[model samples]
Target: MTFTRFVLSKRETTLTVVAGLLTLLGLAVVYSFPTWGGLGGMALFAAAIAVGGFPVARHAFRELWLSRSLGINTLMVVAVVGAAIIGEWAEAAIVVVLFSLGEALEEYSAERVHGALEGLLDLAPPVALEILPTGESRETPVERLAVGDRVLVRPGDRVSVDGVVRAGQSAVDQAPITGESIPVEKKPGDEVFAGTINTSGALEVEVTRLAADNTLSRMVVLVQEAQLRQAPVQRFIDRFARVYTPAVTGAAALVAVVPPLLFGQPFWGEQGWLMRALQMLVIACPCALVISTPVSLVSAMTNAASRGVLIKGGRYLEALSRVRAFAFDKTGTLTEGRPVVTDVVDVCTCGECPEDCGLQHAASVEAQSSHPLARALLAEAEARGIAVPGAQDVTLLSGRGIKGTVNGANVTIASHAHFDEYVPHEPSVCRQADELAAQGKTVILVQHDDEVCALFGVADTPRASSRQALAALRARGIHTVMLTGDSPTVAEEIGRHVGIDEVRARLLPEEKVSAVAALAEEYQIVAMVGDGVNDAPALAQADVGIAMGGAGSAQAMETADVVLMSDDLAQLPFIVQLSRQARRTVTVNIAFALGAKVVVFALVAAGLATLWMAIVADVGATLAVIVNGMRLRR
Candidate 1:
């Protein structure tokens, strides 16, 4: 019963169980028959070979045939034949066993790379807490839940759909999806995504999207979609192994046969030349070299998942290490997109009451126009609760500013360049205006009763982390550059704030692409990071495009090789480090594989290595390379 239980286990355990069973059976048979020595010997040999040779044969066959082409397996076959011709069947069998064992190890290592991403399929609940008409509660299948359904999400539960708070407030931990460690605070009308953990406080949420379109489904789809993409071209060694294996095997066959026949040498001797040829065949097995890369790749992936860096594949991993220059957009990449009013400037003084004059003139004139600057001024006035008097016969001068009459006072508030023609008297106001403009602040001049009053300064400020991240990147020897659509003054101001070394301003979309290409010539490799539609062209051209995936457009993410799961700039340095580590690992695995083969080749010619030893060497070499590559996961 114990023996039966052992035999019913998985493949990894079968070898031990079968070996024990064969040993016991052989012993029993030998005791029963006096001539059982020969029979027992054969049984022992078959059991040992089964425990050894079968695996190698299976692996070599799969690697040779299952592969897109037959290169490596053909070599192993030739080696086996040479051993058999020299009466080294046991040695040949051992070689096959070692080769197969190495192949299995490689497969297992490759499996580690994609071990994360538990399909959120099961996270979808069968029933939802739906608040129906008349405020009655109903437990309906999540499938029945549609847009606008108010789902009552309890504390410590995942939100069932992407929705806004129709009633209550709660906190949601979005780490599972966004890789953000902090739990986001939510309030009414705030859109909470599905699959995010509802941390504290129970809340009612109105679903704005169906279950299919929810974040959970989208994440699963994205991961799956990413998988369907092809990996970068296989590493060079693996490709070489394809042609190398078959050619080596064919040569070994010719060595074993042609030499014995032409030279009239006996098939088997104390030192069988055929045996030497077989050993030579065994020495050429590239299993270790081939398995080395995939194993490392898989292990690296598995480790990275634990840390929330869902690198799509090994190719992207390689590309990340090679990025030399990083291109960034200003509005969101380096600064908070939320702009606020900072200062006001006026070139012309509205005698005695400068404040009211500029406010009255600029607000009235800007109210007539429909530009962002105009809106900023209007919003500022509204926020201050200033009762803006009616402006009469407001005329918007195209490409300039605006003019009108506010409370019987002639008001003309325009861009500083345009206002120069109308308001001219105050040198202090002009200096203040120039200072603000130079710092990248948008300054709007105001003039009432033909006197300049004030200039409103508006600008998007840099985030606290942006400066720190820039410094850290610079410390790591990476050049930090800013690409902006703003004027040179504005670009310089923002560049100084963030400690960026280079700034490219006033670039059109096509120009940005050309700039990146030109820079690529001097730089080792470049990574383009941007959030807007204007950045699409350059992002596609980068060696490794790091898109701000959360705020990023679909086109940007699709074009980029590596997408920052969150807009965390700190992850930039971390990714670059990861790439460096992965590249080193790849090199190490390659070296290990090749080094093992070289040693085996020497041993074979020296006649110190047997077929069995060759098998062990091949399996050991393959296993070592795979394990080495997996170290990148660390």
Candidate 2:
């Protein structure tokens, strides 16, 4: 480490130790006044004041000169000097020692909160085994590795860059990047992130992102930026401290001068007005009150980040706790974005059709399309060992479906709504489509010329954890709503399966924004959850915006106020509980800090508190609030 860093690392400990030793030596000399003589003891007291008071004095001078403000350090220095002027050398030295120790403890507690980011920084390894073009591997620094460079990862080694698996297979532990407890199975085509551990088998990964641009690096930078952003309550306390500190200084001045000069009050005695004024200054420094909210917020944000939840700032963390309504986008937020073919029914009116004839026709027509539902149909056909011939003269029918020529027959596949509006279908087929839609499946009709042949039921089902997540939210009395562009029947069925309280379907992007605005008006604090691209407008409209599966998408990470690194709805309730607990911690810390100061001020006014007792109260309260804020790290 550099000399500057070394000194900074040890500065607080050095200050605390130096002040403590001086305090003990000064007290010993004062107690042995008869043995050392008055001159020697006074000289020792002067040395103690110079040594123990310099740090506090310098800070006070800098703040006064630069900011033109009287801060907590100013209060401490004034109180210490006043005690020294009153010839209370022992009290002055002890006050300086106790105050230094309190500052040291507060600094240490703040460092512990920041240590979470340091832990994240340590996760990515600096080196990787780069595979050259000749198929031989050589150890190289991660910074030298470029995009498309292949790296060989051994079992039990950390993946050095975010990449896709090009060869071999393994079960990679993604806890560092995604907070997932179970190791994920990685194959040749699967994407793996940097900082994940290759747990089981050796693999070769093709790098997609450079070392500096990796997911772990981005997370660390964003977390550092997040800690710098203050919450609403923290800003309020800071402003309050600006006014409160100067007011206390003026009050201390009044207590020192008014009673002694205007009335018959002692100026230099043990219970004199000046002594009471020094005690007031020591007790009402505002150190604890000023620090209470920010420390709690930083600790909470770091804790959330470590668990795969990137809360962008203290403002969002505080807002998340107050969210009364949660608006979720349907496609990629609540359900698996990939639809699967569930049921394939043969509805051929002509008896000449063979078994599985409807699926073959639908798959052949959909094979040319890249849409999710088309993929589902193709996958079903492939799984059944059915062959699909390439279609000719294929054309997309706008938003409805696709039409093509297959096996000398004109094959057309359209959505259920489009089929009802434009195609001539039998009542039995309509009833079958309605029954399938009621089960949360999207229905697509397979028509050959004027005759309907098949009905394919495709559905993007809810995630396994969706029902539990919604139930957890409901248990917390948070209303859940689903806003989607899907048809009303399918959206409501999916909503019912997931226990949503309200379902708003057939919503355009702008309509989703309006729904979010309405929810914000009624609920006061609404959170919009989505894939973060299509729902960006609504997400920005709500009080807090949460994006799902941020680990894969840079857009999601940049767009939302909070990003869940993994596609786990369970993390939603976890972050909610964490945010609420953090808010409660902030409240308790503020209350305790202020209450302690108030009680100490009362005791000082009654002349029952001395300089040592007042400094102890002030230092004790500051340490108490720091420790309380640090509890969120657990």
Candidate 3:
């Protein structure tokens, strides 16, 4: 890389190098008194102070002027100036140099934490092959490609736009965007995101979003925003530091003056009270304590982002660690949102229905509707290779079912309630429907005029990982509850299947919010998990809102505090585990930093700590906390 790029990217490292070299140069001049005289040594020390102390003094004065408060930098500046006034030029130069180096290392540690997520910016290709109207392709910048433009992705190439596959087939590796290890099979009409690799076969994708608004770009933006937001612990430390710095400065002042004036103690010697005060000031910097919480939070957030979980801020991550209850939406959370036809019971005795069964007629009428149950019927019919003759004059029965003319006969598909209340149906068929409903299946009756033809049992099944994830949460002593709009029977069945501790059924969007609020009151900290849009109110009401299938929906990413990019319930357990670990790391870091400072302060009081020892204690604590925080990156 060029020098400019290196300096821009590794600014903290560069600062440390410059400050260290200047300090060493000053030390060499002072020690080599034979070649360079005492005057020359003094000049070198002054130069070192001028260069290394400039930034320290500048920052100190800037903060003093703008915030009307004294900071750690001000304490360092005062200590250095006092040492210089006492004719300790070498010590003053070394002190400033060490402070500068410590600050740079702290900044460098923070940069590394952010780098884990910022590296995602490079995953997407800058340009894409845009297919033109004349069946030709041109290399165009992704930014120039608008929505609805078709792009051709060749084999082994990364997809450059968030689009739908218009044609062709491929297994796209979505690890960069969704954290899915296995390559996802993509065919026509399936969504493909930017930064995903087309592993096999070529694909023609129709752009759904511009490059700037794509999933990868949005994730980077969110991660950056998350880094800027401080957790409660970090804010508390900041407040403590603001008060602690000035209080320590005052105490240092008393140690310097009160002892010599009242007790006739020496004030200028190597063991003077003034020197002890300087050591106290150096130990009082609080650099490590102020840095402890934020570094841990940033590292934890970055790690989460890398694993396909987007934590909005440190506040939410910290909140997650303490969550006692997790309220989950059943439809698209614990259970697959996509319902499928599971059972087909033929109840027709008239023998006037379709030869293959009434599935063809049901599919024919359902093809005109866009409901999820309609898709289930159509998918089943397509799977069975049953030809739909197509219905005409299709009329939606308004919250009941659909009615249409099929094969010169009136065919009506209705819900179980509608079937029993209006249409004449067999009691055995009704009993069969009850059995299916008891098993969490939604039964839709297919009728031929006045006679019931077939009972279709449609169900949205639980995700394969749902049981394991809930069990994991329960094992962690967290209460799991299912809050859904499905019927009591359906909700209870799904809750049992997923091993949820509680179940609330037949709830509207507003009711879900109330349920979450009640959970929060009982459990203290409750997390609501949903699809991010339909359950947005409940998600907002909870302490932490987690959205599933975030990679496919922008609403999910925007509505939830935490988003699992892939539709994986298993990530919930992983998030909880990571949050707890992050919390522990933060606690350990704070305790270590404060304990180090306290030990040094006691030593300073006992007249055992020197200027060099004080600087080492401060710098060493900062480094210790930084290393501990960075461990979460793994």
Q: How close is every model to the real structure, measured as TM-score? A: 0.79, 0.91, 0.92
lDDT of 1: 0.68
Clashing pairs in 1: 56-96, 56-100, 113-298, 288-622, 296-629, 296-630, 300-633, 344-455, 345-455, 348-452
Q: What is the full ranking by TM-score, best candidate first?
A: 3, 2, 1
Best by TM-score: 3
Residue-wise lDDT of candidate 1 within 298-365, one digit each (tens)? 55544544443445667767776766778888877788766666775444432466344576567776
- Candidate 3 has its poorest 10 consecutive residues by lDDT at 1-10
Worst 10 residues of 1 by lDDT: 1-10
- Per-residue lDDT for 431 in model 3? 93
**Residue 40 in candidate 2 has what lDDT?**
63
Q: Please, what are the lDDT tens digits per residue for candidate 3 over residues 194-236?
A: 9889999999999999888999989989988987888888889
Q: What is the lDDT of residue 555 in candidate 1?
A: 53
List candidate 2 segments past 4 Å from native: 1-8, 28-45, 346-365, 381-427, 445-454
Clashes of each: 10, 0, 0
- For model 2, give the 10-residue run with minimal summed lDDT: 1-10
Residue 326 lDDT in candidate 3: 97
lDDT of each: 0.68, 0.87, 0.88
